[model samples]
Target: MLRILFCLLLAAPALAAPPAEGPSPLWGMLQVIFGLLLVLAAIVGIAWLFRRFSMGSMLGRFQPARVVSGVMVGPHERVVIVELAEEWLVLGVTSRNVNLLKTMPKPAGHDAGQPAANPPFAQWLAAAMDKARKRQGDGDK
Candidate 1:
């Protein structure tokens, strides 16, 4: 056992490459670290390009339907108004069924020159957040 251990210990230095074989160990280590960083930077750049450009044409050119508004009528039910082409569909949505309540031409405000009644997503989100904040403040009182 001692002979085996001693032989293994003597062989350890031989397992490593000679000092003149390649670049310095520090330089090799730095190359590997920089290579890893370069690959990670490339991945992040590609992701940013995809996220920035991927959805622009698709969403801008083809918006088939838009939900104009919705209101909850029950714990598990809602009444939604959706705009499709030139029509507005009033829908009653329950957990089990989606019933069409009415259909009408798009509202007068949507005449290309005027903005529609439904606010943009950012505005709606801000308003919803504001309401939530107000509710939270009220609760604290």
Candidate 2:
């Protein structure tokens, strides 16, 4: 019985010998990294699904209401024209509140098929430069 007890004590120490150095620090870090990656993947997948189904119009590309034009009135305020549901609205927008200033019918001849009345600033600048160059050449001749 004494010999058996000693052998049992020795066997217990061997059994509890720290589990073969457990897991390395690198293995633990890898597990944490993989877990974070999995969480990120889940978040991205949910966002993609939401975008694919067009669940949130504010986040999606298409919108029923759009800003036709806007101009800054103050440092933090803007006067904006919005087009919605075939009606035009002039709104006073500040950082704190948005107020409807006026409502008007959609303007005639404002069809999307019509080209803009004014070209971009860059094009206007280029045309002015070309005219100046032509004038300079004419004066030289």
Candidate 3:
């Protein structure tokens, strides 16, 4: 019984070697971090490209640029618009009572301070109504 107990104790130590395959925990975590960083860089690059293109267009047309103003925003929504060149760009707007009007595709010499054709509330309501009507029609069909 004494000899058997000694043998069991010796065998336990043989099974204590650390794993020696694949990446360590630290390496795995580093890889995940690097991947995230790469993704972020790509997003930034794409955004830069878009900005450059938009700016180029504005410069090409030599249009006077203006900023959007007096807009309101809501908690559950955001608005984004890129006008010709850089005439008026309203990004992440959350106004419940805002309207968007059409502008000349080409650059205009003057600031055409026209209201947007569709207001935020009207657009949202119209979209919702259209969706509801479509759903009702589908049900009937």
Candidate 4:
């Protein structure tokens, strides 16, 4: 019985599961931080590319040339009238390009002092809704 007890004690140590070997907590944290840094770098790279590609249009907005008005012609195209010291340029703006469609002398009536270039969207929407309601009322009558 003494011999059997000693054997069982020795076997017990061998039978128990070995401690799980895994990356240390510090190493795991470092990997997470590195992954975060990679994502941050990618974001910054994309922003830089966007800014570089769009610099042409942005330059006019910042420089002596001022954007008088702009309207969207399509999902990815726009018509913009830019004002300079002497002349106004009509520009056709696309996703990756800007073209001068026309250039004309600044109109005598159009100057620095002007009301809001466009009416508030909310007011426009309200006006349309009223028109619709009037039409519906007329139809019912």
Please report, in order, the local distance difference test score of every candidate based on alpha carbons. 0.80, 0.77, 0.64, 0.80
Model 3 misses residue 6 by how many Å? Answer: 32
Clashes of each: 0, 0, 10, 0
Candidate 1 CA-lDDT value: 0.80
For candidate 1, the 10 contiguous residues with the lowest summed lDDT are 113-122
Residue 46 lDDT, candidate 1, scale 0-100 = 99
For residues 64-139, what per-residue lDDT tens digits would candidate 3 score against the true structure? Answer: 5444333333565555454646455544444355446433353455345754544764576568669989999999
In candidate 4 the C-alpha lDDT for residue 8 amounts to: 97
Task: Estimate TM-scores for all models.
Answer: 0.47, 0.47, 0.32, 0.38
* Model 2 lDDT-worst window of ten: 113-122
Tell how far residue 70 is off in model 2, in angstroms: 2.4
Clashing pairs in 2: none
The true-versus-predicted C-alpha distance at residue 3 of model 2, in Å, is: 13
Tell me which of candidates 3 and 4 scores higher on lDDT. Answer: 4
Query: What is the overall TM-score of model 3 with all chains considered together?
Result: 0.32
lDDT of 1 by residue, 91-113 (tens): 88999999998889986666543
Error of 3 at 68 (Å): 16
lDDT of 2 by residue, 7-100 (tens): 9998997788485577989999999999999999999999999887775665646567777766665799876778888788878899999999
